[model samples]
Target: MRELKILAVVVSLTLLTYYLVEPFAHSKMHPHVDAPNYNFPQADKVTDAENVEKAKVALEEAEKAGKEKAIKSAKTDLANAEKFEKDTNAFWASAKAAIADKGNVANGEVLVTSNCTACHSIESKGFPPVMDNASAAAAYGVVPPDLGTAGKLYTKDYLVGFIMNPARASKVTHKFVDGRVHPMPGFDWMQPQELADIVAYLESIAPKTMTDKEVFHNACQRCHSIKYGDMQKGTMQAFTPDANIKTYMGKVPPDLSQYIKSRGAKYIHEFVNDPQKHLEGTAMPRVGLTQASEKQVVGYLEKVGDSKKAQREELGPKFLIYLVIFAIFAWLWKSKQWREMH
Candidate 1:
């Protein structure tokens, strides 16, 4: 009887924790995340981004009909729908045009050396970072990614915006407010064509196809290590630990293998879009990856971290039913035992 009572207490406490305490804690730590948006939501508003063409058509039709009032109204609607691309935000348009310019690879290489070799390195092309790893960590608080990988991982629009304004592109502008300097400075002065040439140079050196795991590492493993099971070398340590990196980051960046469970897809998406929103002063910069690259990275993380998630979800209900039935039987047994004692 005593043993049964003890079992009942343990079960009750476990049930309470599972049902109540766990949920409350989860609400706090949250999957503060958003659904994947394949279209780069932050791209500059294009003149025809929406169904503004419908309004334009209406305006043309009204002009032909000679309805002055209708034409005027249609014109207003058209204007409202289409926001012309302009400086700072016009990167998408300019990048598209420059890429269409078919990028002079030679010019791009020269531009990259002239403008970028100071802070970044293109190891694929033998451009070592101006400051060695330790010095860069001390100065920038994190080592910059190799531009070669960056070009492959980020889209034209994203790279242009990043070059123009690193803080804005990464969506960590919040952290840059009030005299705090962002590590990456803005190069808004560069012409869109110049930016294009640099990107073109990067693409020229990139392999046409890459594995998803390789994509994730190229995008993340410079700073974050996946100790959960690893996406690198089939071992849990995708990246080696370093004191310089730790001091730069205030700690070793958390292993990413299990963040899919803790942060959730939505949180990860939101985080990639903007890091300062969640962790105000984290050394991790907002990646500002376009929808495609972002999805790839998150998907890779899910693959590594949550392989058994579907299976666990499938079995959850059945296990819960078993626990409830067992609890009911236990309650009845306890009641009968007490009755006999009485």
Candidate 2:
């Protein structure tokens, strides 16, 4: 009877102690922090001083972080944004006029082959796949017809407009001839001069062809970017950590791996080749490569930029499978210890 009473007393003491001390123990491990109150007249003055000091330190840290991010974002923006064309309208018109000129197509063709044809074949031989009418229509769900007979089929105005905004004119406006959407996107990155030169060359144009993971890396990397956008603009309150690579670019380099894709690469190339080329008053610079180098870079871009789509698509299942496996293992491991403790 005495032993039963003593046990009851011990249990009661434990319950009491737990109720009183458990809160503090939990608080120690995961503290509930709040800003100090400074509402009282005397208390407010003293707390205000401390708050001001803390705020100043925080502001300085934030400013330093901001500057770093701005510089890094500037680098990437400069690289990709440099290619955007100034006046898209002018670009198409000039290209039409230039292609009509005699030496233009020959020179442009030479430039295209020396730079572009290696990774991008003109006619549909077997080697590098051609992004011709049939394939393009099947892939994009619209017809771009064929560039093979672009000179014969399209007027300078039509050709120029098509090249300037392929999506708008080719997909949205025109009838589907080949049962494929045009694969060509806008070249908003070209400078006025570069656009004119390329357009003049394309006037009497022909056909073309195109590659792979290993072969892809070799041909498409130079002018092709796997990343885009200014990393410096967005931040979640100070010290909370930036949610993306752009946030870190101020302190560390930004990763271009996430943004690279066919669509993104095309956009990036345009930006790099021309700054004010898209909008009226843009501020990006041309990297100023020879025609051959530009084409090589574009080819390389097709490989690298295209790879990201496949890679990202694969990540979801992989992450979920791993997470489930980890949770199961954690449960199994903890079960033994729990039983032993009980």
Candidate 3:
């Protein structure tokens, strides 16, 4: 009876430990958010007539002050504003023209392989063309993402805009803590028809049904590895040499083997969508994955972290019932033994 009581106490303590530690681990992994919430400037607002008036006023003020630098800056701003107005009008015209043409997927595939495959991989198999992420990180600050899932992950309109002008599509300008800016260069050189074809090719190659596992493989596996039993999905090659780590990220990235258990699904979703939003100066840039893909990645993480979670939950009530019956029998046996003694 005493041994059984001790066993029950141990089990109760173990359950308590899990409950307490789980919450604490989650809290540490996902503290209160501190990063700035950036609102991207709309294209319409960028070329608004009011901005032209403001720039004109600033130009006059700077000229009156006789400040060459200020005057030059104001003039530059005014010129840019006017140019954007013109460009916006042209973009709409091109969009209308492109909408009528259903693009050639074959031509787009060729274009992607020729131009894009230099930095991004369309094929899911084998090492990517830009295999050296360390060197790529040194040059571009962040390793470029694989284009395997791009078609399914982004809308046609967004893909078109991003292909035309990456910087404009992603309006937020990310500045690193080391005073370096990491901006994606625009590809305004690609013609509208060419851009349309590339989008079509991407759509052609996109997975019809992207499982959660595929999401993790395509998006997270480049920098992270998941260990399921003895099987490993990706390599954990050093992002860069230790000497250059400070220049890039300031610290080595953590293994995400148990990230879901430690951080929780909500934390994973927010972090995956925008890492900088959770941790300022994090090396993990926003990969621009769709909300669905992000959720799928989180789901994959949860599965990896606790493969038997469903089974555990299903057995919980039955286990509790057994414990109750055992306790009653234990009490009854003890009572009977004491009664005999009396």
Candidate 4:
């Protein structure tokens, strides 16, 4: 039918626009980034890459000119740099092997309690952070998550690198230049065994089974409150008051209630894994969540925002069929009228 032909053209164009044009536009807007690299192989990939070699050469030249101390320092620097690169590249695999071989859960607990509890909480032990969000924001410029699910929700390797170096783990080491200081500078100085021990402790505290909602709350609720996400309209709030978050962060973080629908899964995953990649200088810190945790967070976001996604998809084809059927009936009626005119 002529009507059907026009409708087909309209539908084809719509599908092409949605499936092809929109995706092409988005790809240009946000260039593709590989999945988060827990190993952080090139943690200082951007900033410290050239500097290390340059510094060593300069130090070597100084040593040649009769500065005995400079030669020794250059060798030390070169060795240290080489060791750090090797360790960082191999950190994830090494951490897993260490944890299995010699991870001491008890010693890890002691280490985390003494060193990590000041900023983080271990809900299983009922240890709240020593400092509240306002004070924490003043210190770190953003709120931090509780370590309640860090063990299970984060990959073992991510936990290791994150503990060893926060900025490196988050891919934001450049922001810490000129002694600017990250709120939580990781204990990179810790021995490999020591880092493994702390990870072992965190793994011990995680719940064996967690619902998607629990994953979201532990990972996200501290800094981002959901929109109308509470029992009442005004019930939900970030751990820190908006004023303190805004004073340093420059803007209130957007409500994530509808972001799953707006930003879509691909964008949300990349953004959450590394905020700096999406929004340069965004105050949102990479929380170092495991892929499973990221999936659960996205799942919960979908549940809250696009609860009808599955239903809509199921009904879409049926609705299109009904439209076509109606179009056919109208076309039939119009043909009968044309016969009368003839």
Candidate 5:
């Protein structure tokens, strides 16, 4: 009994340590999402247009003031803007031509049925009827999303890129706290046309009216919840006399109301793409979401979590101080008890 009591104390302290340090560990492991260095020619044109307008205004003011240096600077800005536009147009034209060819949707359907059905469901009610949350959560740490709504959630280009190489397409490099890499294996062996066909098939079957919240409901609510105001919303079924979720999950999953504030947007994105990377043995599985869908989910998390983060963070130090005080008193009490026993 004494050994058992010591073991219980050790286990309790281990769980306490995990809870206290988890946020700090996550912050250290995955910082804020950094901007990608890759240039987007299409988006640059809008910035160039704004620069051109500013330069024109500067030129007019310089000429009115008879300031040669200011006039020269304005002309330089105008020249740079024109050069950027010219280069951007050329790049955009070439990129469009390279990816101009469309894929066959019929072939894509065949491919999806043959290759993807084992781990994924193409239809909402098909063979191996969309694996239930518990079984899927047990098998892969999370339920695989039905592909029927995927086309609506993702763009054709993003779908193609992800199907070809999930890790490369995601561009996530942060190592998980446990040092596990992404669980997704790349299918780079597939030809471009074949991948394109799969994208087409996905698009063909995707629901057109699926909203961001609906996407979260479909893909995430199974293991996560969002508490807003006074209402709690989630996909998990309510527990009853016969069905206790704790038996399956060990404990109820954490509420995602403040997840973005706790984990950061980049961490969320990386985790969604592959959760095993950030947390080994995590019940959250890779949802195989397109970049757009992932962004939408993260956007929702940020919107809900951003408002109260400052207040929460402000209280963290106070909590730590209280814990220290409590620990000191507890130790003093234990020492006094031993003295009295002697």
Candidate 6:
């Protein structure tokens, strides 16, 4: 019994050491080459040129195969861009009607106080104080126009244009010394009434606080206000959304709309469940999902995409695989020790 116990201990230690040493030993192993070359950079450049030509051929073939697909995608982008143009016309019409209505000023006050305070501060009772046009001119050397009498300075069409894309407005005509390109960020995320409220409230504030007060320090104030004071944030494309995720998978990720439209819901459901089936060389990891949860996400995309809902359906298989592997290793270790003991 004593000899058996000692043998079992020795066997267990040997197994544990083998497991730990295997990774380091593998790393140190050398290639059995006739001439060992340490210059990966030179080799990589030569390999890269060959790969580039191959990629060009592949891309041309893909484009040829999906010419209609490419055109459809471009059209979709054009349609979404046009939506903004229509929204602008509707916004101005609403603003003009609201100014004529008696209750509009009151509703505008509520809307402005809630959404505009993050940047603008007009002195309304029980509201955060914003620098009036006069105060702003005194401090910043630029007069911010009062919004209250907007009809006098800007036509209804002009107001609509400004609301739609404030950054694109002309500098000379409006004495909008701040221009449509004023440092003030546009109110894009707000609802239609909320945007109208801001417009209405600005129209009211022009006369009351015409003087400019000093601008406060904000998240972008430090670097932007000092160095790029005169420069506008350009429409430069720095980082594309989901680019990193696509790079990891070694493939160009299709635009969400095109992927869904071409492949159909069932393909997306299976691809999310098991990427290996759709593309053999795809580096995207499988995130296991239940049939029911997959259906829920498919239903959601009919209205809008919800990543959180899809993820909740998918993350289980990875966890299950880890547990299974760990169990198998533990069982093997125990069984080997028991045999040594006998």
Name the best candidate (by lDDT).
Answer: 4
lDDT of 6: 0.42
Off by over 4 Å in 1: 1-102, 128-132, 177-179, 231-253, 276-284, 309-342
Per-residue CA lDDT of model 1 for 1-342, tens digit only, reads 787799799989999999999989987876343333323424324322434666778889999999889989989877754543233245444445544455677998998888888888887788876776567776786777778777667776667667777765565554566887777887767776787887788878876766767778778876877776554556544232467667645578777888998878878877776564466557677675657677888888888999887899999999999999998998899899989999
Compose the digit string of candidate 5's lDDT tens values, residues 1-342: 574699699989989779877857866866433232122233334544665786788889989999899889888978866775565455444334213448788998898898777777655636464456556555554455567777777555445555654433433322222664444455656766777778778888777666666777666665566765123543333211112334334466677877887777877876776554556455443455667778878877776778666777899999999998997898789888989999
**Per-residue lDDT tens digits of candidate 3, residues 170-267?**
43333432665443555667777888888898888887888887777677665565544224544433434444444555555666768878877777
Candidate number achieving the greatest TM-score relative to the actual structure: 4
Per-residue lDDT value at 88 in model 3: 54
Candidate 3 lDDT trough over 10 residues, lowest sum: 34-43
RMSD to true structure for each model, in Å: 11.3, 21.9, 10.4, 8.5, 18.2, 23.6
| lDDT, residue 292, candidate 1 | 68
Residue-wise lDDT of candidate 4 within 21-43, one digit each (tens)? Answer: 99899889887765654433443
Predicted structure 2: lDDT: 0.41
True lDDT of residue 182, candidate 3: 42
lDDT scores in order? 0.70, 0.41, 0.66, 0.75, 0.62, 0.42
lDDT tens digits, residue span 121-173, model 6: 44334444355534443443333332333422333333433554453222112
Cα-based lDDT at residue 181, candidate 2: 38
Ranking according to TM-score, highest score first: 4, 1, 3, 5, 2, 6
Off by over 4 Å in 5: 1-33, 36-101, 125-130, 171-185, 227-254, 260-295, 302-342
Model 3 lDDT vs. the true structure?
A: 0.66
In angstroms, how far off is 332's CA in candidate 4? 0.5
Instruction: Provide the lowest-lDDT 10-residue window in model 1.
Output: 38-47
